[model samples]
Target: MSSKDEKNLTQVTDKISAMDEPRRSTMQRVHDVIMTAAPALKPRIWYGMPAYAASASAPALITLRNDERINLALTEKAPFRAAGGVDGQLMPAAWYLEDLDDATETRVAEIVRSVVG
Candidate 1:
């Protein structure tokens, strides 16, 4: 079983480790940020990706995707209040992440804090 076969991976770290490089490093960085920012969210494998949720019985609050791009997606359970929610306004629930610089890390931390709080 190769690491690329993420379906059978039940552990969060294993799944992230299995990914191909730059993606793998990016995912790992995101993983660290998420856990540090929102320690309440339990780490697990959800739909073959690294997912964080409130508990074993709760839905995932955030999920990371491993594709051509590293994707960060928030579930409906995440109370992420963006600057828009009006009739004609729209907010991005997901983002394709590349690098985790200081600014990006801060933003990610803020988002996870908001989600968990």
Candidate 2:
């Protein structure tokens, strides 16, 4: 990794480390899931939060932030197409996560994989 990328990773780690309770564990788990699902995505810090992107020059594909609730969001850069409402008219690009069970984690991994495509 480059020096700047290393610094960004450190900042993200610090941010995650500073979180309290379920947020910390949840973010860490989500981060792990994202990485495992899409190994090409590089982790970095964006807006003081953990973010992943194809490259530093590219827009972030995913970002994680935790406060009252944990948020896992896919950026506009991601191929966010979902088939639900009226021939895929309505789609969700972001999700609020409280915790991750096996099923939820698997779903999250699937989402990340789809986004990676």
Candidate 3:
């Protein structure tokens, strides 16, 4: 990793480590799930959060905030078409979802597989 990327990762890890129990647990759960599912992926800090992708060479599929929310940025036209009428209104490659549940977790794993596999 570049020196800048290492610094960013350090910042994100520190921020996540400082979160309260609920938020920290949530972030750790999501991080664990992603790491388990994609053993080859690399993690980095992006937008003040923990982000994982197939590699720094690939696009990020998951980003977890210290506030215990997971952010999924949709990069394909399919997600926009599948968004239906969500409040965020899909915008090609700019869709993001927060505060996911168990079902959301499954859905996220599917999305990650599709994107990174």
Model 2 agreement with the true structure over 1-117: per-residue lDDT tens digits? 878777777877788989997788888888889989988888888787899999866788898977677888888888866677674776778888799999989999998888888
Q: Which one is best on lDDT? A: 2
Task: Give Cα distance to truth, residue 23, candidate 2, Å.
Answer: 1.1
Candidate 1 differs from the real structure by a C-alpha RMSD in angstroms, to one decimal, of 5.5
lDDT of 3 by residue, 59-115 (tens): 655665443344455333222334456635544343244545788668666655654
Poorly placed runs, candidate 1 (over 4 Å):
1-10, 80-82, 85-88
Query: For every model shown, what is its TM-score relative to the native structure?
Result: 0.82, 0.88, 0.58
lDDT of 1 by residue, 1-117 (tens): 334333333488888778888788888999999989977677777887888888765788988988877888888887755556463356557878787888988888887787788
What's the best-to-worst order under lDDT? 2, 1, 3
* Residue 77 CA displacement from its true place in model 3, Å: 12
CA lDDT, every model vs. true structure? 0.78, 0.84, 0.59
Best by TM-score: 2
